[model samples]
Target: MSQFKVAAVQAAPSFLDVAAGITRAVAFIEEAAQKGAKLVVFPETWLPGYPNHIWLGPVAWQMQFVGRYFENSIEAGDVHDKAIAKAARDNSIQVSLGLSERAGGSLYIAQWHYDETGELIKRRRKLKPTHVERTVFGEGDGSDLVVKDTAIGRIGQLSCWEHLQPLSKYAMYAQDEQIHCAAWPNLKLYEGGAYALGHQVNNAASMLYAVEGGCFVIAACALVSKEQQDILCEGDPQKEALCPVGGGYTRIYAPDGQSIGADLADTEEGLVMADIDLSMIAYAKAAADPAGHYSRPDVTRLMLNSKPQRPVMAFDETAGLAMEAAEGAAAEADVVEIASAAE
Candidate 1:
């Protein structure tokens, strides 16, 4: 499709409850569908919530929520994932979801893209968990850096800080990605301190991604509720200065780096919808396509290994044993032939 409407969800997760979060997400999806959204995007780690505690407290202090966080994280094809897929299927809308993925004993900040039929089209983890994020999340691999051709367009995504990685962004651009989902945690100024992370920085990152990639950017950010801040910072006096509320700044950007639609209130929980014309990408690309004519392949080239990283590889034990036996028999025959020659 050359033109369509898309939605970016700006809301807090249901704290650390997967079921509650799923229910909330489905509601958002259905609402977006009702609003005529072809694709809906959610904030970073929307399911079961972001681990703001890691940034708020020391490791020893943050230990309290670790188990709960793990317990609430979604496993691929598990009940939580199935629920999300069903929601997309029921609404007949494509969904791009940010979630905390649990596997074995470790957790990863993951994104799940479901097609209109609710079939998972892409699943990716953050290639490198940013700063404090490393405390609770595992790194993704090259295979995660992929764009899928969909009914909407060639869609691809990168989690929170992945936008900061130039090579990663170029990889997506190289694939002719037309729709980009830039997921992020709440961008807030907790203490009004001089060192606080500014909203400008995150917003610029998304805009730059659209400009450089020549694609529509759906910048989805989560909102920090006062209750969530209170929960995370209950005992520590520093918590007040750490997990402040009102950090949402969800937006959509055109391929030329212009903001799309009406801006949502920073503290409000809602969807930011934008009607985008994919043909605009051509105009933007003509100005500058970093991965295309605007680039110098001889001066610099990127080697991308898209092999999926796995901790284990299973082989058929019966077949392996038979192969081993055959090899042993061959060795025995060689030895016998040598012995006969000697005699």
Candidate 2:
């Protein structure tokens, strides 16, 4: 928990291409590490890319790319995962990566942490997908809502709109998260009508989270390139208006809600590095520590289930054999009773 430099990336993924994304991400990691970054974070669903089509047109229209999306979505311990980890290890830096995780037939927005040595440490998914996101991604269990104690600090993350979830944010803060990665899709609106969902408001939400939780916030936002928009909005005439390009605004905020470094341009693609002093967290917490002196356990408390939920639980061969033996014993006893009665 000492002073260290952290990097946040605002870059475009190789839309629907996991392998290309891995290569691009590795290059970015190397670039950031060269700049003396101890830790680096990427935007939500940086692998392949965020489902921008979901927000552009109807659900039926978005279905066209689902196949390619699924094919490119990465699985934990897959080749792409190993490559990203190796990148971190090679650079000698800790990494927090965001990607579309494919588990079975469903996809989940996930983040994986790699230690400075390139060892996989913790993996977490988005507790809930927002609005159109639900169309493509599945919900994460309580276990996904967590923080890990890393060489950098107590690092935790939440994807996109999860930053608005009061309970979710409190859950991480309660874990004493020292560095929070706020992973977000590109913050482009159809017409900038809902400014809250736009870059400015989303950035504000990240800064507020940092101040409230007394943690350094790495606001990693994805970039939506013109090419990506054209592809996602091909059939629709409202393409330009609905899916405008260049909405990457990655920034780093201190515990006091102050920007740690120069904010990246909304249209920029690169890493924003900031040297964060963990000691500053003490100063912010001194005024109002949400999980410490400021909380009221007597009145209200947050409860986390943290259980890995699944549709089915499998049993081993030993358990199956045990059940079979008991059934056979019962059948034999019934036969013996019948034979004795007949006698």
Candidate 3:
């Protein structure tokens, strides 16, 4: 639809409990649907939670949470995944969900999009996991950068710092994305020291994205509960100082770069709902469409390699096998001809 209501989720996950996370996610989905939201966007790694501990302690010391986090990460198309999709279908709401995607022995930051009918329309991973996130997550390829058109509109998504990528943002804008899910983990963890990672900076990034891309931006951020603080800090003053609680800075913005949703307390858990009209993008883009008439493509352009980067590829043996079979048939024919000549 051209105009509709949407929700941005700003709640902490169940923290290393996939089952509990799924249950909570389903409840939120149902609740959003009841509230007349056609779509709901979740924060980054909402399932199994973001590993803020990686930034808190040394890798060796933080190994305690690694195993549990890996085990709790959700797999695409798994039963846990189907449950979330089912919830969307039952409620007839579109969902843009963020989580850690597990494949074989590795995990990648992922966002899955489900249409109102519950069909998975797209699943994208972060092209590059940021900072210490590399310790636990693998990188996604250009193929992961995609924008899909559905009954609602063209939906695209990026997790956390992916929005910070200038080229990545341009690529999505080029595809004419109408609605964007800018998923983020808590921003206030190290606010005392890391000013760049605070709500002011990250929230500005989301607002700039709406203005730049001429698309509605759903900036969903996660909160840090006391339970999460205790687990990571372990009653240590230093650790507590680094990654403190309360970072939920959830918001939604219009194509004109204005806040469209009401505010929520930094520590509070809830959804930020906003009504968006795609028609607004037309005027916004009319003045300056970076990827369109306003751009100087003759001077610069992006080289997007949207191909799946696989580690291994098996070669085809069919040609060699066919040659061998043909040789054997020829040999048999010669022998039969010789026997006939001898007779």
Candidate 4:
């Protein structure tokens, strides 16, 4: 479709509770459909919440929350995953969900995209976990960089700082991605400590992605609720300052790098809606399409290995054993032949 309405969610997670988070996410999906939205995007790790505690203290101090976070994370195709997909199907709306994916006992920041029919079209993880995030999450690889062709448009997803990746952005642009879901965690982190983690810089990153890719950017950011703040801060005034209350800065940008989505109070939670016209990308691309007309292949090129980096490979044991036996038989025959020739 050339034109349609989309929603960028700006809210806190159910805070480390997968069941509650699934229910809340389904409600949001239904609400978006009711609002006449074709698609809805969610914030980073909205299911079971972001690991705010990782930023609060060192490794030993963070030990308390690690187990709980892992326990709450959802595995792909698990009950929680199916619940979100069912919601999309029931509502007849597309969904792009940010979540903490638990696969083989390791958690990775992931985004799940479901088509209107409730089939999972794409699932991507952050190629690299940012700073303290590495403490709790595993890293994704090149295979995670994906842009899918949906009935609505070419949609792609990236989480948090993945927006800051120049080459990664180019990869999506090359795929002719039309709607980019930029999932982000609550920007209200380290209140006074890091400017990079704050609102302005991250929003700029999303805008840049829109401009460079000539695609719609739905930047969804999670918030730090009162309950989350209490858990992370633990009543320490110093901790509170770092993990202070509101950290939501959700926004949507046009292909021309304009902020088209409406605003809410940084502390308030709601969906930031925008009407996206895919054809507008042509206008923006005419000005500059980094991966297309504005190219310099001889001067610079990106080497993208879009393969899943797996830790293990399984082969058929029977086949392997048969091959070994065949080789042993061949060796025995060769030895007997040599002995006969000597005789």
Candidate 5:
């Protein structure tokens, strides 16, 4: 088993400020690097901030501000790619961070990885955005849900609530993901009521599930404050329904379901570090590997096949035989119409 130190960064992201978020992330990565961490992971959608407001129940008819909120999100391109890559290269460490990915015209909950040299390694879009998130981000295909081979082992990622999906977890387990990156925003108070206990319980359950699957899980969570919430939900008090202040449960778990690292205060920006040995994976799997042993493969198997769908347009074709025929017919019709008019 190869030994490596991993860090789970728990921080607060500035709302709608991509540059500032990147800067803060870079600082966290540098701090982790100084602490001898080879790889660092950040919470979900830390870039451009998580739009927690959408989850705050139904919007009032008068409050059309929800749509305007998404307009401030960031896109993935040279600006973000270069900045993030440079951070990884400068620190000489692998980095996995979540952000809102603007693809074509739609947004996706995306996680991106960078190698030690600051090169883009892999990008995984969230399989499904939870509840109101569907209103803002698009669903991702299986193609983007993957584990990539890296120097640190087979690293994989799942954003927020995707960890709750059984099939999604199985997909990563089947790929033999040794290091699983789980990103999440801080759970907040719901407008109809106070903080939901279900959010924290689900988070813990997901962490334990990762360990049960024989993987080292780095769970990162955002730290939202009352001031931040106030800024995000200024005009309409209903926006308060989205996310309340102060619920940071960032943690790291081992393959044996042990809490290896966590933040005690859950208020400030910090990181939880743990030493992970890849050799433990073999030991854990020997007990029970869902995809390997203790399975009834003869009964059923899951197979995924995907095809690309391309958009069609009338003018896009091999030559223009149809166009020529149409032109000739139009000329005949014009002549007939002119003759009829003369008569």
Candidate 6:
């Protein structure tokens, strides 16, 4: 019908301080709302902070800070739900914020969305954790890849490096996602090599992918500073954990591979707004659709099916079955023994 206004909020989050981060994020949301933002998206791990210690190698293992990191992380419970919902309702704007979710004694990089009425809209977890992040974060199942139909548009989410995985992006595209949320951490300023290039390339790739899929893409990245490092990094200040300073390249792109805003500052706390005409998607898709005219189903096939479930047994039945099965299997294997003459 009409163009929608979306904002990509780029800012540095306080380390291990959920309350303070939420407070700061709420202020930004208020500002964006005041500027007539219909939807506002945040960077990855903006709730508390990104666990940079995991990248410290041996120091991270010996420090055993993951427990403390999980302790300060947010849980997807009523308390957090209420607080976030209230923030969205107060601002009268739809919000999508990324955070470290602690659930079932496991940690996941998660994104939570709240509607204008303060109702919880959607919650999605990162499909796979990055290289070092696997040691601290758990993998998400298919249930986490959700594309919900919202008032503004059909919104979907993918976190950090997951955008690099073609299959993951295709999954969202197949569902016809309108507004894709791609979240990432700021590139390490000191580790200037493939890591930095990967960040920039991945962001550009995701935007291009969205264009190919004919969807609006919002690429949000965390902006960490020396002050944020002081709070997040619990170890020595001179260590490599805090070596990288700031790398905030938050951006917004349209459905035609056009950049709306790019190369934003780390400390600048504001909204990067764009007016997206949903009709552009129809125009682009008519030319080339990946799943339609562009795909060759004759030579190639990708079929996914659900696996069969294992049988379940009662407690006593399980114990007896295990013992009997073990004894039978062992007896059939070998029956050779030597007798001692002295005995």
Q: lDDT values of the candidates? A: 0.87, 0.85, 0.89, 0.87, 0.75, 0.73
Candidate 6 clash pair list = none
Q: How does each model score on TM-score?
A: 0.91, 0.90, 0.92, 0.92, 0.83, 0.82
Query: Lowest summed lDDT over 10 consecutive residues: which window, candidate 4?
Result: 334-343
User: How do the residues 210-294 of candidate 5 rate in per-residue lDDT, one tens digit apiece?
Assistant: 6667998988888786666777667465575556566677888888877788554667778889888889888888887776674
Off by over 4 Å in 4: 317-343
> Largest lDDT belongs to which candidate?
3
For model 3, what is the alpha-carbon lDDT of residue 324? 63
Q: Kindly give the number of clashing pairs for every candidate.
A: 0, 0, 0, 0, 1, 0
Candidate 1: residue 265 Cα off by (Å): 1.5
TM-score of model 1 (CA atoms)? 0.91
Candidate 2 overall Cα lDDT vs. reference?
0.85
Assess candidate 3 and give its lDDT: 0.89
Provide the lDDT at 172 for model 1.
81
- Please, what are the lDDT tens digits per residue for candidate 3 over residues 176-257? 8999999999998787788999999999999999999999999999988889888889999898888778899999999999
Stretch of 10 with least lDDT, candidate 2: 334-343
Estimate, for each residue in 208-290, the C-alpha lDDT of model 1 and write its tens digit.
99988899999999988877877888856677676778789998999888998679888999999999999898999888877
lDDT of 4 by residue, 1-343 (tens): 6888999888988887889999999989998999989999999999899888887887898899888888999998789988998999999999999999999979899999999999999888899999878877888887788798899989999999988888888777888889999999999787667898999999999999999889999999989988988888889998889888889999999988899989878899988998989999989988987776687665666667675666774558878887768756754543311011112
Candidate 5 segments whose C-alpha is farther than 4 A from its true place:
57-72, 191-199, 235-242, 306-343
In angstroms, the error of model 4 at 82 is 1.0
Candidate 2 per-residue C-alpha lDDT over 1-343 given as tens digits, one digit per residue, 9 for 90 to 100:
5987899999877899888888899999999899999999999999989988787777787789999999999988888888988999999999899999999999999999899898988888898899888889898887787889887789888988899999888878877889998898888866466777788788899999999999999999998887787788774667768777888889899999999777777888888889999998889988988777887666666666665666785667879878768756754543311011112
Candidate 5, residue 98: how far the Cα is off, in Å: 0.6
List runs of model 1 lying over 4 Å from the truth.
Answer: 189-191, 194-196, 235-237, 316-343
> Which has the better lDDT: candidate 4, or candidate 6?
4
